[model samples]
Target: MRKHETYAQQPHIRIITGACPHDCPDTCAWQIAVDERTGRAVDIWGHPDHPITRGRLCGKVERYLDRVYHPERLTRPLKRVGPKGSGQFVPVSWDEAIADIAARLQQIIAEYGAEAVLPYSYAGTMGLLQGEGMASRFFNRMGASRLARTICATAGFEGLTYTLGAALATDTEAFAKARFILIWGSNTLTSNMHLWPFVQEARANGARVIVIDPARTRTARAADEWIAINPGTDGVLALAMMHVIIRDALYDADYVARATVGFDRLVARVRDWTPERAETITGVPAARIERLAHEYATTRPAAIRINYGLQRHAGGGMTVRTIACLPALVGAWRDEGGGLQLSTSGAFRFNRNVLERPDLLQGREPRTINMIRLGDALSLDPARLAQAHYRPRPVDPPVRPEEAGPPVKALIVYNSNPAAVAPHQQAVLEGLRREDLFTVVLEHFQTDTADYADYILPATTQAEHWDIVKPYGHYYLMLNRPAIAPLGESLPNSEIFRRLAQAMGYTEACFTQSDEEILREFVEAQTDPVFEGITWERLVRDGWARLNLPQPFVPFADGRFPTPSGKCELYSERMAEDGYDPLPTWTPPATRRNADAATVWQQGWLFCISPPAHSFLNTTFVNVERLRRREGEPSLWIHPDDAAARGIREGALVRVWNERGEVHLRAHLTEDIVHGTVLAPSIWWNKLSPDGRNINQVTPAEESDMGGGARFYDVLVRVEPLAVASEEPESTQQAVSLA
Candidate 1:
C-alpha cells in the first residue's frame, strides 16, 4: 500500500480527511498533507482505503506530522502565571477564556452546587464528535458532575455484559481466521497495533501465538509461547484453563448443550480449579495449564485477545467474568476467529442522547463522579462541597472525607491528564494543590494536567478539528474532516462547547448544533443494527464506513445470545442479581497478596508501578521528541532476581517507593518481568521525569474488581539503589515512610 503522487504539486497542496483521534485501538484512517507552503501540516499517513487501517500507521500515528507540527502546539489561552505545580502561563482571550470559564461555572453553580462543577475527561481526544461530545452536553446542561465513565473497559465491559449478552468483537478481519491465538493481557505489539498485522497474517497461515503476559511484551516478542502470568493472577489462569477444559474431556459437549446456561453450574464451578491451583495462583506451571487446556480444547478455530490490562486488578471483574467463560466452554462461538475480545464497544449505537443531552438531565440526579476519585474529588472540603450527601457505597461503608458532597469548585479539564494519569500520585498532587480549586485545562501540551491550571485552554490537533469516530478496536465508521483551519486559537471540542454555550447564556438547540450540523445529527441518530445502510451521504462519500458485518462474523454462530436466556450466560442470575459471582470466580482480594514483601522491603515498599508504554500510549508519546528519542530514559524492568533482591545494579539509579508516590528510575535487570514484578514503562511528564513525579506517583486509589478500575497492576513497590547518582525525589515523609 505504498503509492503517492503529488498532483498537489500545483493548487496550494491540499489532501485532508482524518481519524486517529488517539485513545487508540486502531481508529486510524488518516490523511492530512495540507502545505500551502508551510501554513503547516505536511503529511501524516495510513488511509489507502482503510479497513482496520490496512495502509499502516502506528508508532504513534507514524509520527503524525511530528505531533501535528509540534512546536509545542497549544497555541493560545494560558493564564496561570506560575505557582500551582508551576509550568507557569499567561496569554488569553477566547473571549477571555470563555468569559472566565463561564463566570467560574456560574459561581460554582451559585455557590457550591452543580456538584461544585467537575468535568475531567478520558481517551484524551477519543473524538466521538469532539470527545465526550460537546463536553457531555456542556456538563449535562450544567448540573455538572456525574463522571463514572469507568476508566477503561469497565471491568472488561462489565465482564462482557455479564457473559456475552454483548461485548462482541471477532471481526476486525477475524484475526485472520485463527487456529489458536490467545495473547491475553494485551500489548498487541504496543497496544492493538492493527491487531499485529492480522496476527501476523495468522502466523503466516499456520496461526498459534499464545503470550499471556506479566510483562515480556512487544507481543511477548512475537510469541509462540510466553505465559509469564501473576499480577492479579489472571483469574488464576482462566480457572486453570477451565480446569483443563473440564478435566480433559475437552469441553464443547454439543456446544455446551446447545449454547450455554449454567452448564452444570459451569461444571460445578470448575470443580476445584485444579492445574495445581492454577500453579499457585498463576506463576504459570501445572504443566502449562494442562498443555494450554489441551491446546484450547483442541484448537480448531480458537482465539482470545482479551486486554484492558486484565481488568487492572483486584481480580478484575472475576478476571473478566472468568475469561468470558472460555469461549463458551470451547464451542468458541462456533468459529470465524472463535471468541473473546473484550469490547466490541457495545456494537456502536451512538445517538448517546445525541451526545449526552440526557434530555437536559433535567431529571438530574447528578453527583456520580468516580474517575478514580480524581484525588478524592479534588481534595473535597468546602464543607464537603456543601454536602448534599453521597455515601451509598463508595468502598462499602468507608465514606469519611466528611461524607464528600462537593469541593471541586469548577474544574473542566478536557481529554484528561489528571496530573499524568491519576490514581493516588501524591493524592493527585495534593488535589492539584487546591487553593480553592478552579482549574480549567483544555490542553494540547502544558499538560501535567496543564500544570494545575487556572485555565489553560488551546486544544485542536486531530489535525486541527472535526471528528466522528468509533473504535474500541475496529469496526470502522469514521470521519474527521478539518485538516487545518483551527491550529492557532484552536477550537473544536465542539467549538469549545460552542464558545461555552455562548458564554453561558445557553439558549440551547443542543447549543446551536453545527459541526457539519452536529455530524448530521450524529449520523441521523444511529439506531444500531450495526448502523444498517450507514449514511451521512455514505459517510461523506466513503471516508470510512464498515459496520454491516457479516462475512465470517460468526456472532455466536446462531446460538442467539443477547441474553436473558437467548443463551450463553454460563451461570449468571444476572450475576447473582448484580452483587456478582453467580459463577465467575477467582475471588482474590484480601488485598491480593497484601503487599508485605517483608514489611514492604523494610518499608521503602517497592513492588511496582507504571506500565503502559512499549513506547507510550498512557501518557501519549510521553512528550514525543520523536517518541522521546525513541523512548530512552524511563527504566525499571527488575528481576535479576529482583535485581539481586533490590540492591539494584545494572545501570542503578533506583528509588521507586510506596505509601503512595515516589519516582526515580534506571534499574533494568529483567527476566522480562515476574520475580516480585517491577517494570515502570514510560509515563514522563513531571517535566519529563528525573522524578519530579510520574507513574501516578506510586499509584493507589486502588479500585478494580468490577470496574471502578485503576489499579496499575495493583502496585506494590520497593526498589532502592541511589547511594547517590545525585539522589533526590523522595520526601513526603520519605514517600509514605514506614519506619
Candidate 2:
C-alpha cells in the first residue's frame, strides 16, 4: 500500500531458443520470455520459423511457462527430514547439501568400489550436453555402474540396424512426393501436430494416406482409409500385406534382385499368412487387407511413417522388423519419395561422428545392465547375487551380506523421474529406499522421485541453459541459449558435473572442458563431408543448420545398404541367430481373441495410454494450473457399449483392476475408442492418497524380452462402479479431456 511499492517492469518480450528434448515425434523449438529485472519468465511461444515445427506450439509446451514459474519449484537443495516417500523435507544450504552428497557418495565408493553406484537417466531433458553427455562423462570417470544403452528404441534401432546397417531415413520434405503414404501405428495428427500440416499437403497433392493402428485415432479419422488391427498383431498385418505383394507378383523384380538378400525365405514365410488367416487374428477384414496391399504395391513412390508406440509390446521389435521389410520388398528405396520412413530426422549423417568421438569417454569402461528390466536388476535375485562374486572384471566393492541385489549401493538420477515414469513405481521406490544406497537427484521441481532423495539438486530449466540439441526424431539442429540467469543456486547440468568432478579430485580431461569447447570438439570430428565447412559459431548464428549429404533426398540408391552383404536383408541373419524367425513372420499376441470365438471378445480391455501433447510430461506439468485445469486427472476411456455391458455410468467413479494392481479413476463413456478397448492417459500419480493414482499399478510389467520394451497395452482389467455413490461424492477422481 506504500507509495514507493511500484510493480516491477516486465520486458515487452524476450527470446530463448531451444527445442523439446523428449523422445517425442515432434521436436518443437521453443521461445521463452522473462521480466528484465525479476528474471522471471512470463511468456513462452513456439519458434514459428523453424522448418520442422513451422512455428506451432503444442498444449504441453505453451503451458510449460507455468511450470517454470510455479510457486512450488525447488529453489534450493533439500535433504530428507522424515521417512522416505513420506514427502517431508527440510531446506538446506547449497554448500551443506552438496558436501553431504559428496561425502556419502565417496563413502559408498570407498566401501564398495565405484561400480556400486548406478547413474539412472533418460529422455527427461534431451540437451546433448546437459542430459546424456554430462552423465556419461561423470559416470565413466568415476568407474560407476554400467547402464544399458537401448531401453525405449532398442528394438526399432536393432531392426533398422540389421536391415539398413544404419538407423537413417529419408528427409521429412520427401513425404510430399510420395504417391501413397502408409502411416503405421502412429497418430500423427495428435502426437505430431506440427507434421500434420505436411501430411495434409501430401493429401492435397493426391497422395493416399493409409492409417494402420489397433485403435481408430485422429489421424485415422482424416485418412483416405483406416485399418484397425488387433493390438500386438501389427506383424501379422504386415506379413499378410507382404504375402499379397509377393503372391500377386507386384514387386519390383529388378530393384529387389539388385538391392535385397533372402527374398526366397521371406516369400516362403509370408506364404502361410494369407489375408483370410490374418483376418482371424487381426480382426481386420480380408478384402480390405487385400485391397490395401495391392494399392500400396501398385502406388509408385510410397512412404511409411512408423511411430514409437508400436515398440511397447512383447513382440514390438519383431513387428517393426517385419513392417520394415515391406519397402525393401516393393523396391520403394529406389526413388526419392519411396523407402520406409520410421524416424525422418535423417541425422545419421551427423550421429556417425558422435559415435566416433574418442575423447568423449576416453578411458572409462564400466559394467552394464538392461534398462527395461530395472525392477529385476534392483530386486533380490538370489541365484544371480550368488554368482555375482565370481563374475568378471569391473566388480563393485562387496556389499554387506544383507545388502544383496544388483550392487547399486548408490544412485545419481538426472533429467528422468523413474518413480512416476518407470514401469513399476512401487519397485523403483523400494530400490531407492535401500539403506546402503546414497541417492542424488538433479531436478527442476520437487518431483515424486526427488522426494526420496538423500540430496535434491536444483537444475536450470531449458530457458536458463546454453547448449546444442540434435533431435533423435527430427533433422533440425537447435541451439539453446541462456535467456536468463539460474534462479537461486540452481545450476546447468554441465556445471554441476564439473563441480562434482572437482569435488572428487578426478583428473579427466573430458570433464574439464567448457561446454562450448566440447561442442567445438564434436563439430570438428565430422566424418560427413557436408559438415566440413560448418562451425559451432555458424550454427549459433543461424539458430539452426541442416547437414549436407551427397544424396540428401534419396537414401538407398545403387543397391548398396550398410549391411554386411551390402544389400537389404528381408530375412535378417542376425535375428535368426538370436533364436528368432529370420524372415518377417507373424504370431498372435497372447491378448488377441481365438478363431473359434462366436463373438470377438478380449480377456481384458486393451489400455492405450499415451503422453498428452498438452498437459502431460510424467509429473512435470501436474503443478501447472492452466494445464491441470484443462486436464484435471486421468480418466479411463471406454466405448458406450462396453460401459453399458458393464453396468457402468458416465462420470462415475470406476475401479480398473488387473493382475498387477488396481487404482480408482473416473469412467468416460465415448465411441471414440473401439468397443473392447480402453484408453488411459499415462503418468498420473497422487501424493495425497495412501495408494497413489499411478496407472502402472494396474499395468503389467511383463517384459517384451523379444523387443526389449514393456507390453503396456497387453493389460486387461475389469471395471466396476464404486459401491457407495453419493449425489455429490466426497472423493473425486481425476478427469482427462479429448482435446
Candidate 3:
C-alpha cells in the first residue's frame, strides 16, 4: 500500500450515517464512505447539517477510518499464554472462551458470593446502548458489587447538582448568543472543539472571550484575556468575584430576591473573600479580578463554559459550585444564552431504570465500590471489604460486607482501560496481577488493562454496532445504525453481556432484547416536551434534530429551578446536612502547601498534566500509527524559568518525579505554561516510550476532597536532565494525557 494509494477504491461511493462514540462531549454525526467493490470504508466525514459539528470533525476523529482498520485491532478471544503483564496470549474460539469465563464466574460467585465479581467500565464508547444499557442490566441481575462511576465529572457535577441540579443549565447552542463568554479550565479549541466556532462567532459579534486556566492553552492563546490562576484556587476566585459584585451593588437585585433563597446569606459569606484576598491566593492581580467581575456583571448575556479540568484537584467540587453560582448572581439566567453551561443531557427523557433494571437484583443491595479506588480495593483482603479498612466512597448509604458478600475476586473490564485511566495505577496493576483474580477484558486492542486479563474477549468497534447517542454537551438524540459487519468474532459490548446472562441461566426477559430493541424502549419512553415531535423516524432521517425548545431556551427565566425550593441553591441545606459548607469554599491542594517538597524555593513547582494535543483521546488513538507519528512522542512542557533553574536545555531529555513515580521525556521550554506550572498531554502506550513510562508514573492515588475523584493536578515535582538510574522501574509505568 503506497502512502497516497486509496485502499481498493470502488466505482460507486455510498454514504452511510453514523455517530462517533468515543468518550467526548461533541458526538459528531458523520457519514461513512463505503466502497461498493471492496466492501471497505474509505472515509468518514462530519455531516454538513449538524447544528453543533457543522461539517467539520475534531482532529482526533478526522482520520477515523485509520483506527477502524488498524492492524493491531483485537479480532478473537485470547487466553493468557505467558505470565501476567507479559502481553502474551493465544487465540481461542468463542465457545471455549465463553465457557471458561462462565465457569470461573460461577466458581467465584459460589465461593465468595456474587459481590466477588466487579464489573469495571467507563465511557470508552459514549454510545448510550453499548455504554451502560446492557452492562448495567447484566451486572444488576448477577447481584455483583455496585460500582461508583464518578471519575471525571463526579466532583464538578456533584457540586453543580448540589446547586443547580443535574443536566439543568444553559445549553451549548446558546454560546453564540452570549455577549461575554468565560471558558474556565477547558481547552475548547482542542477538546470541546465544536463549541469554539460558536465562541468565535460570538467574538465576531463583539463579545469577549476570557479563559481562566493555570496554563496558557491553545484556546487561551486565542482568547481576549487569559487569567493564569494557581490551581485549586478557582473557588476563591469565584468568591472574590461575588464579593465585588455585591460590594459594588452590581448584582441583579430583583432577580436574586425572586429567584434565589440564599441571597442575603451569600452576600454575607462573600464579604470576606475580597479581590485582594483572592489575588494572594489565585496569583491573579486584584485589579484584574475586579475588572473581570465588573465585566461579567455588566455584560448583558454573559455565558460561562465550565469544564471538569479544574475539579481534578482535591477541592474540585467546591470549585465548580462556586463558579456555577456566578451567572445566577448576575441574573444571567434571565437572558436566553446568559448562564453557566455545563451539560444538556436533561433535555430528553429516557427510561434509565429500563436500561439497568435494579429489579433484577432480587433484593440485593451489594457493597458500593468506587472505581477511582481500584488500587485500595485490590489490596484489601476479600474478607475485610465490608469491615474496617475498606471504606469505599459511599454513593448512598453503603451496604455492609456481611450483607453484600466478599471483596472482588473477578474483574470484568469493558468500554474502559482502568490500568491506565484508574487512579492509583500501581494499586490497580497489583490487583490486576493477583493470581487468584479472574480478569476478563473486552476491548478492541490489547490495552494495558487487557494485558492483565485471564481471558481477553474481542469487542466490536463503534462502526460495527448499534447504539443511541445522548450527549451531555449537546441536545440531539442520535440513533447509531451498524455501518459495517462485525469483523471476525468481535461482538458489541451489549452482545457480550447478553451471552454472559444466558450462560448464567438468567430467566429474565430483559436480557433477551437486542441492542435495537433496547434503543427502541428508550426512545418510546421519551416524554419530555422538548422532544414533542421527535419520533424515532425523524431522527433516523435527519441524522440529528435540536430539541423543540423555545427560540431562546431561557428555561429558568421564571425562577423555576430544579432545586427543592425551585430556586438556585446558593446556600444548600443538603450540603449542611452532609457536614459540608452550605456556601461553597476553597481548599488548596495539599501538595502545593509544602514549600520544600521538591525544592528549596518558597513554592514547589506544580506539574499539570493535560492532553491539549488534538491527536489523542485518553489512549484511544495511542495505538494508531499515523496519529502517533503526527503527535510525535510524549514530551514534557517546562516553563523557561524552571528549565533555566534546573540547567536543562530546550528539547533535551529530562526526568520529572516526586514520591509517587518518575518518567523521562523530551523537554519543551516555553511560556505557554505558567511560570510555576508544567504541562503534558497523552494516552501513549507504555511500549512507545524508551523507559516504558508515562505521566501517570508520578501521579499519586490521591482522591479529591468532596467527590472521591482522582486528584490529578494536586502534584508537585522537579524536572532535571535524564540520568539513568541503577534500579529498575515499575512494570505498570504507562502514559495518558486527556486535556
lDDT by residue (tens digit), candidate 3, 101-196: 999999999998998888888889888778888888888989888777767777787788788866676777788889999999888887889998
lDDT over C-alpha atoms for residue 277 of model 3:
85
Residue pairs with backbone atoms closer than 3 Å in model 2 (clashes): 48-55, 60-614, 113-397, 332-339, 604-716, 633-735
Regions more than 4 Å wrong, model 2: 1-14, 33-40, 149-151, 344-346, 349-365, 380-406, 550-552, 587-614, 688-691, 705-707, 724-739
TM-scores for every candidate against the unseen true structure? 0.34, 0.88, 0.93
Backbone N/Cα/C clashes per model: 10, 6, 2
lDDT of each: 0.75, 0.69, 0.78
Candidate 2 C-alpha error for residue 259, in Å: 1.0
Span of 10 residues, lowest total lDDT, candidate 2: 730-739
Q: Evaluated with TM-score, which candidate comes out highest?
A: 3
* TM-score of model 3 (CA atoms): 0.93
Per-residue C-alpha lDDT of model 2 across residues 263-297, encoded as one tens digit per residue: 98887788899999989777789999999899989
Worst 10 residues of 1 by lDDT: 385-394
The C-alpha local distance difference test score for the whole of candidate 2 amounts to 0.69
Q: Give the winner by lDDT.
A: 3
